[model samples]
Target: MSRTMIAALVLVGLGLLTGCATSKDELMPTNGMTMQELWQQGSSMSAGDAGQQNIAATRATLRRPITSADMVEEQTRYTREAANEIHSQFSRLPNPDLVIYIYPHLAGRDQSVPVPGYSTVFPLYQKPHYAMPGETARPPGRTR
Candidate 1:
């Protein structure tokens, strides 16, 4: 290495060491607590030291009786009519159901009892379609 490069590196190392150093005045407490008092407080703190009474007081403060306004808010949040309004704010386009009726027929070779007729329904599309803004409020056919 050259002389100038080595001298510059030494100066930079010394500058970094000085930047990391702290004075005794800066370490002293500004909150009127002396070093001796701080040492005593630190020595008193142990593994079993816990503010259990403080926790109980906080819990008691938070556990105040619920007001009627709170009950009203909860009612609005959970009621079926409000629930539909909340969930269906973006009105969904109606997907008509396709009902297929199965006729009664005999089944099984050994026990050939007649199978009752039944109907099952499936949505017209694979997924429910949603309407755009200002679109029809209700399904196509019905009024009101």
Candidate 2:
């Protein structure tokens, strides 16, 4: 009975492993088909037509071109709004310090490519400005 149970467990484990171990060909459902071929295949085959249609619609929506005038107008509006907010914030604060950090590209290698499972961002240190001449306000404590 013990041997039969062990064999049954081994067979089940093997079945699970087999399901996960797929070849590249199996992973790529389109195989060697071009865009036109894929469209044609999807149109002919009813199996994945709904999914294909959804993907096509999503791609079409994503490919929409934004006009330069629209982009400039959005940029100007955002800038004005941000400036107004900053002005309001500064008016309330006793002292304000504006600092910008410019990170130059590393000597070699692409900065666009992300380090897998890890952030490529560098640490930022900012010195807080004091309000009074003699008295200094206590720094905000770090919170988890």
Candidate 3:
């Protein structure tokens, strides 16, 4: 390659290396302040004030007052979220009781003893207990 092209490539490589060498402090300007201090400085304005401003802006942008349609939509959304939570909880629980009935049939070719038809019943889990949300799951035969 030409001398000028080589020098240009070297400079570009140096620039890239320097860019990658940036420290966390350099990336985020905390102004030599502690995390709490930085947070306080950044959040000088009260959250209530910001919320009010957003509410005012929304009110200004809205052409009409909220109607029954909007209320119904929000109610439906809440209902769906509640139903989803119930479904998640139900799914986390163990399966229900199961029963199996075997039909009366002949025994082996030797025809030793006839196997009697019977019904067996057993729970999906020995201990049908459920864990609350955010709780760790316990294995069978283990108790918390």
Candidate 4:
């Protein structure tokens, strides 16, 4: 190819590549005001008038006295929630386990009954004890 033609092709390719590589800011419409300023201008009076009307309506509704039924319902809901919290707080942890090994032995009236070697498993505590707040759990003791 001729030198001038090669140079023209390179320049056109570079221009095409640069034109395709555009930023998001360059795609947005240009306005004198920012987003916040535009929103303020559009909602200046309507927002204040609507907010004042809503506040007055809410205040008027809140000024009414509570009925006996409403009071009883609210009290019942509070009492139920309190009872549930107490029950959850006082819930117990699982009991610790105990494993025992029994050696072979003979029994019965004439001492002729032979028992095979076996093991028994049971819980260490009859009642469960839950740890209090801010208390760390204790590690189990090592067994021989």
Query: Highest TM-score: which candidate?
Result: 1
Off by over 4 Å in 2: 1-47, 78-144
- Lowest-lDDT window of 10 residues in candidate 3? 135-144
Candidate 3 structure quality by residue, lDDT tens digits, 61-86: 88677889999988875574665665
lDDT of 2 by residue, 1-144 (tens): 699999999999999999889877778776678899878886777548797888898899999899999899888755746555543333322334445554554333655653334225432424433234323243332111
In model 3, where do residues sit more than 4 Å from their true spots? 31-144
lDDT of 4 at 23: 75
Q: Mind giving the per-residue lDDT tens digits that candidate 1 earns over 1-144? A: 999999999999999999779776678645878889878787666322365566677798899889999999898766768546534455766788999999998888865888999999999999877666457669643322
The global C-alpha lDDT for each of the candidates, from Candidate 1 onward, is 0.74, 0.60, 0.72, 0.73
TM-score of each: 0.33, 0.25, 0.25, 0.31
lDDT of 2 at 27: 80
lDDT of 4 by residue, 1-144 (tens): 999999999999999999889975678865667888988877776569788898788998989899999999888755746555544444445577999999999989998999999999999898767656334254432111
Instruction: Count clashing residue pairs per candidate.
Output: 0, 0, 0, 0
Sort all candidates by lDDT, best to worst: 1, 4, 3, 2
Which portions of model 4 miss their true places by more than 4 Å?
A: 1-87, 131-144
Q: Report the alpha-carbon TM-score of model 3 versus the true structure.
A: 0.25
